[model samples]
Target: MVVNTGKTFDPQRMLGTMRLADVDRGTDASGNHLIRIAGKPVRWALGCNFDVWPWACPATASSDAVRFGGDIAQLTDPTDTSIGMYVGTNAYYNGIFFEEQPDGSHALTTDIAAPHYYADGSTVITGSIRFRVSYDLMRTDMGIPNPETLTSTSLAGAVKTPTGAPAAGKFVTWHDPDGGGFFIEASGFTFSRKRLLVDAARITPTRPALARTVRKTARRGVLVHTRALPRGARVTSYAAYCRSASGHVVRASGAPGSSVVVVTGLRRGRSYRLQGGRELQGRPRCVERAAHPARPSLTLRPRAVPAARPAPASRGRPRGWRSTPHGRCATPTPCGWRTRSRDSRMVLNDSSA
Candidate 1:
């Protein structure tokens, strides 16, 4: 029996289904004819299955009788629309696409040698063939309509979503002439790709400026602030560099779009050029080490007085006692030596003198 499996196949899930076309002769005389439902062409893959009854080649021989090679000749004639078989065999056209006829129908013919063979038995020794053709109604089998016919005001209108509207955070993307594609993001968040290429050329970036503040950290520190970015601009992070240290410039970074960056380990009285968005100068000072007082000193003066006589040279000057050229005794004064003091008169006596 022949069965057509195309009517019940699912286009979304199934590639295609096989349908029995027809047989060449015998009780089944159906022909190869595919009826088109819609005005669409079919791309089909064809195959043939042949079933031979009464296994024995000669009627008098038993079913197990050994059949010689070439007992059933191969099919001939290029225009033949029939399948003949003396033995069970299968034939397939592999997986190649063949478009349906302009009238939406497809047919195939196969040749068989001595198509009609009869033997003396209750069962006829003819062959029954089923030509199964597989065709896809979806996917590659169908062709897209002309693009010029499609019109829409927005992408959302042309390509609709199941929910009738795009979901949050979704975007409509299109390729730019420069290269990468850009999209209009739904949320208010700034998007880099969405920036109009023309706007880039028109909007000039203002000279970058920096604001700095002192940090009261254990170690001397400074905080550099960066200006906010322009509209539709995207920046991941900011870095500050010292302009003087070209060879080994110290770099400090801050989070994306952050206002301030911390820079520490600075010299007390030294100055630094901080360059984040722009170059700026900074200095660290110590104000807790400059607030004290002083002290006083006293000096004594000797008043004019009669010179004291020097001790005899032979006796030598008494130890620890020296005579001044002005006849004033110093330090270990001799006995009975008197000197006027700044506050009042004072006298000293040395027993050795």
Candidate 2:
């Protein structure tokens, strides 16, 4: 993590570099035009420093400066070495989070405690290390506050697919509850629906229980199902199987426990799966939720909109013009998405009024 003490760093003392996204408060949803509110600031716009390196202030540093450029091999004390880093990645972010405090300012916070491990063999902490970075559109002090020490824990685990086959090829990565369990992302931002996990096709290759589609359809919609889950538990990967009325089979599956599956490309029927489960994050673990026999089946169907009725021919007026309630002309043109009133002339919009 990077911190600036409202001071400037000698450019010659900077060693490496760092990067961060611009700070954004929000936007005015309604206005004559889209007006960016608060606005985003450079990572170190208020002060400077990245990681352990010193930073130059805006007055002396380049425009909207962020990182520092100093030599690490040589230090002021001739004992310590290295400097400059404004970002940290050891702690897997559960999701991009931002919040507003009682003071009317926004705070970006998370609960991932990552221990500091140095490759230079200089430092090792078996205890917990917490991280916190605050942002304020009004604050003039060092924008990013330093991280603090807090209650912490050590995390590690292992996951094996099966004796005969394997689920994924990548390393058995253990993502903190925020890092997404091994392969599946259980926590963070979950939309109403999920990507297609069950494969929709005539032939089922991976497993025999998974059904296949008999026919295909044009448009597709999502099918959703929800069940009670423990706090912090999320759906990582899932499989879906579907069948037609005549016993024809169709299937869909993606990335592990995808909540939603594409049931299109097949005739109007239903996709049925005997069982499915979500992969929960935390320590390396194998999901047994979708492999049970007593589990309930899920069904998804797409709702298609009927075609629109044809508009009647113009009432004896110009080909492109139509009579408006006022003594004005109207045309069906897909241009702007707003309507406003001038001094004497007003635009007739079917959407607004």
Candidate 3:
């Protein structure tokens, strides 16, 4: 009879009629036969050549009168009847064994750590085991400074000034961060940004026509005539000196449109010549003789005039020298007339003589 044990079962047609008496059966003369059964193709009986233990027999052995109800069959362990065993291959046991930890964590046999059993009969698995399909790690470090902070002051000690009084319509000093320290200028004076690096005491205004004449007189140790000066002009002082006739060796004081500077030290009643420009109208001539007989007559005559010497032809300035209209030389040379040309040369003649 077929027993339905709630599992799939297919019996061989040829073996369906086999009875207990038809199959070979053997037993140990003293006790039961030993039999070990696994999920192999051939069925084995106790005392068979393939049986591992001849004294024990599988519970499913025919002689044991074991009948499976359906496709499933449960067998009791020969050593311990309390435990049940199922017959299957690798496919059944591959996912079967597992352990749970005290923290309710579970692991399989393939896990890194072995499954553990607790005193409370609970099983646990410990240790970390990573199964990563993909992993990536990144790190970055940088250094940056504050944008609003000022680092240094390089122009701390710089100075600047106007070489003289700022003239009308011209910037006394040009725009420069380092000042005009190294700049050599033509007309204007050079200065730094905040103060003058060089002394500007020698710089003066352009000489006016009136100042020219008085300057010549002061050089001769004579009283310069300043009555015809501009109304607001002041006579500062007069400077004078004595030199051989025809020789123009002298120094003068007084600035344009200012006071005449007079020099004190001089010998009285000595024949002397007087010369002046816009402030005075006269040529250099000897003073009138003195009146006292005891004193030698200080007779002043027109100083012996020296013949004009022709200027030597200039070798011409080097290539880069600047030519200026004011008859002064400046670097980074300027362009202007060098000498009087034959066409523009003038000759003076006495018409009334």
Candidate 1: where is the Cα deviation over 4 Å?
1-199, 202-208, 215-220, 243-248, 278-353
TM-score of each model, in listed order: 0.21, 0.21, 0.14
Error of 3 at 126 (Å): 81
At residue 95, what lDDT does model 3 achieve? 17
Model 2 lDDT tens row, 116-136? 222322333121111212212
lDDT tens digits, residue span 26-108, model 3: 23444443222212231112211222321222222222122221122233333321112112111001111223423232212
lDDT of 1 by residue, 74-152 (tens): 2354322212211121111122232343323221222221111222224322221222211121111212111111112
Computed on alpha carbons, the lDDT of every model, listed in order, comes to 0.28, 0.27, 0.22
For model 3, the stretches where C-alpha displacement exceeds 4 angstroms are: 1-203, 208-258, 263-353
CA lDDT of 167 in candidate 3?
A: 24
State model 3's lDDT: 0.22
